[model samples]
Target: MGLIVTIIIGFFVGLIAKFLMPGRDPGGFIITILLGIGGALTANFLGRALGLYSTNEAAGFIASVIGAMILLAIYRAFSGRGRLTH
Candidate 1:
């Protein structure tokens, strides 16, 4: 039950992140889902460490999206150099 909810939320989070940072991203739905989940985890961890969020309060959707965007930026930075646009 919890897992299903996570997946569903992850999907939407991924979509929102992609919409905000439009570009030629690699992979499809699966990747997007992973990105979303990763983003949420990242935000949760970082926020907790920084005292911005409590254990009872997981990172919200906005933070998740922001985290996804950050990951996307890093992905592009590393992968962009290896690919030829032309």
Candidate 2:
């Protein structure tokens, strides 16, 4: 049940991140879901470390989206992609 909820949230977060960033990202639904989950985890970890969020709480929607964007940016940087244009 928790995993299902995470996936659903991830799906929407991925969609919104893609919309907000507007770039040629790789992968399909599975990839997007993975990205979303990764983003949420990253946000949660960072938020907790920075005292922006509680340790036991999940990241908020906006934080999740921002985290996804950050992940995308990191991916682009590592892959040598200059900018996203799509």
TM-score of each: 0.87, 0.88
> Which 10 consecutive positions of candidate 1 have the poorest summed lDDT?
77-86
lDDT of each: 0.88, 0.86
**CA-RMSD of model 2:** 2.4
The lDDT, on a scale of 0 to 1, for candidate 1 is 0.88
* Candidate 2 global lDDT: 0.86
Question: Which sections of candidate 1 miss by over 4 Å?
Answer: 81-86
**Which pairs of residues have clashing backbones in candidate 2?**
none
Report the error of model 2 at residue 30, Å. 0.6
Question: Top lDDT: which candidate number?
Answer: 1
Off by over 4 Å in 2: 83-86
